[model samples]
Target: MTIKNQYGIVKIAIASGKGGTGKTTLATNLAAYLSGKQKIILADLDVEEPNSGLFIRVERKHEEIMYKMIPGWEEDKCTFCGLCQEVCNFNAVLNMGKLILVYPELCHSCYACSELCPEGALPMKKQRMGVLKHFSNGKINFIESKLDIGQEQAVPLIAQTLDYVDKHSENESLVILDSPPGTSCPVIEATKEADKILLVTEPTPFGLHDLKLAVETMEKLDKEFVVVLNRYGVGNAGVEEYCKENDIRIIAMIPDDRQVAELYARGKLVYKKSSAFREALDRIAEYILEN
Candidate 1:
């Protein structure tokens, strides 16, 4: 189904509150299945270590340098009043006893140092945090952001990757974003403005707890979401009960299939081998189309 929202694109984010919960497995397979019928791309926003690319072989289309501006010390403009240090919550700016040290690697690029710099001593400098890579293999379009080593912030790269998708896929039908795990700033950036969010979760207690956190985040962001219960038979019924009690929709359940796991271990798409996984994704895709 070619679903389009106000942005002229259907942005569906596949996310999980905890890692190893099968978000990449769901996103890649869903995108691959949908790509046959629609103009779609799978964006791997887990820049810290993007593994979705390993599942699919894609020809490199292009690359763009994603940069973030951070504070740069200007010794000429003096006056280290410690305001920059006080304002920084990330501890990026360390007002040394003599030399005011500015660690761009540690900085979140919040501009607290530059904005509050009374002396304008710390000017903004361009720091290459990552590169957004675009790939295409006939019908399958893929995009992923790779963060440079020592770069602490991932939200900027995620935003850049989404911007790349928008610039190229404005007329396309769907953009499935593989969001980073946890309800953190990076996850927030990845899920923002998504037409629908498919939360991947398991049946364990930890899974349910983190799913609750993810549900809270979705509620706080006022985004519509449904839970995809991965490894359905492995854990307790807590997640299902919580979803039922909270009135959350459990869209699809991908059973604990050894075939799926074996295919995944081989760096293959589990849906391609297992009928159960394919059926699960088909149900979720139909739900998206219907809704």
Candidate 2:
């Protein structure tokens, strides 16, 4: 299947309700498949544990540290009025009469504490949270962001990675975002700007349960999304039945193959070896291009 340039840059986010659901598999192979015919920008937005770079062979072109703003306490300027602590809704600031403590992890970077400080004791300062790397191999441009160990928030890093993708992608490029799993703040931040979301799930009972939560999340966000059933032949038809009952579209079903697993274990792309996997990717690419 060939993609026409009529759609401009189509941002497609591949996400799942849980981990180990082949979210990275679908994302990596789909980007590789599409890169054969067109320019593809594949971004791994799973900042906490990004692993999409494992499957693709690309040279790192750029790397940068990502930072988030947190309030810095200036004790000399403080009047001990306790206003900063009161204005912080996240409990990041604490007032202890003689001294104030600021917890960076608890800070949401809303700037409320800094902006509302009456004595200018609280100033917003940058704190390192993650690192973003840009990689490429001719047709495929890969971007991955990884959060620093012990970083509590993924939304800020994910947002920064998306900004990088937006700034670098061309108008005709197909941008595919590999989002973090689950229906949480990180996933929402990763897929918020996507033109369409593809939720990958298995055929098991757990898959169906989490898929329901993911569907509900997309519905609340009013985002257009479809399902892609991974490990199709291993589990029961519960996920299929649930999708049918809900009138949700299943765009593609990747079959369960041991060779696929073997290739994946070796950090290889299954589409290069398995024809069935390639065919499923083609279906997904066609759906993306036609829509």
Candidate 3:
């Protein structure tokens, strides 16, 4: 069932307002299901802790270290002008009379301090932040980026991963982004350019609360999005009611099945074993193609 759409390179982002809501489950299984029909690229943009590759079996095609630009202080070229510290909004640069310090964790890569330095003492340098790996199993191409253990930021790595996808993917192939869990900067960077976003959530009070936050964020970004309720048979109807009140569409509801959990625990995909799960994936794929 290759999708024939007028839009080139349809990008669908699967995200959640909070963690542990079956976001990766949907992403991995959907990619697996779609790969049976046409070529697809599944990108795990949750660089802080990407786990989509756990459920997938792929051979590594390429790997590279990811870096972010940060100002490096050179004392030999400094005259203690204090310009670098004054221009740094993130407090990444500090002048202590005789010495200067640059914090790579705090730097946002705006290059303000380095670019405006009169003596050119602060030079923009590449600082290791993460690593990106590309893998493939014929039809399914998987890209995963993992942030360094002590890295403080994730947006830079997420941005670079998307750039890699843009360069490698064909205009007609489908690209599914497994975004980070939250409405923060990393999530925004992952989904901002997506053609459509599927916000996954469980049907609980906590899920409803975070779903509201995610919904508000999509509204602010003016993005076209829908909701998917996971573990649907156990929780209350708060998610359904809220979606109805807000006129938000509930695209699919995956039932709470213990068999699904058992397979997931073994790092196995459920679409091949669970008919219910495959039905949900069919609906999701149909929605993506129709819209």
Q: Write the per-residue lDDT of candidate 1 for residues 116-167, one digit (tens) a residue.
A: 8899988889988998888998777899999999888888888888888887
Per-model TM-score versus the true fold: 0.92, 0.96, 0.97
Task: Please identify model 1 stretches exceeding 4 Å from their true place.
Answer: 79-83, 115-118
Find the candidate with the highest lDDT and give its number: 3
User: Candidate 1 — what's its lDDT?
Assistant: 0.87
| Better structure of 1 and 3 per TM-score | 3
Question: Quick one: best TM-score, which candidate?
Answer: 3
- Model 2 bad stretches (over 4 Å): 1-7
Please say which candidate is ahead in lDDT: 1 or 3: 3
lDDT of 3 at 133: 98
Number of clashes in every candidate structure?
A: 0, 0, 0
Candidate 3 per-residue lDDT, tens place, 1-291, comes to 676467568899999999989999999999999998888999999999999999989999999999999988888999999988899898988999999988888889999998899999988999999899999988999999999898889999999999999998875789999999999999999999998999999899999999999999999999999999999898899999999999999989999999888888899999899888998998898889875
Q: Residue-wise lDDT of candidate 2 within 1-291, one digit each (tens)?
A: 445456578899999999999999889999998898888999999888899999999999999999999988898999999988898888889999999998887889999989898888889999989899999998999999998888889988898899999999886899999999999999999988999899999999999999999999999999999999999898899998888998999989999998988888899999988888988988888788765
Considering summed lDDT, which 10 consecutive residues are worst modelled in model 2? 1-10
Find the 10 residues in a row with the least total lDDT in model 1. 1-10
Task: Quickly count the clashes in candidate 2.
Answer: 0
lDDT of 3 at 274: 84
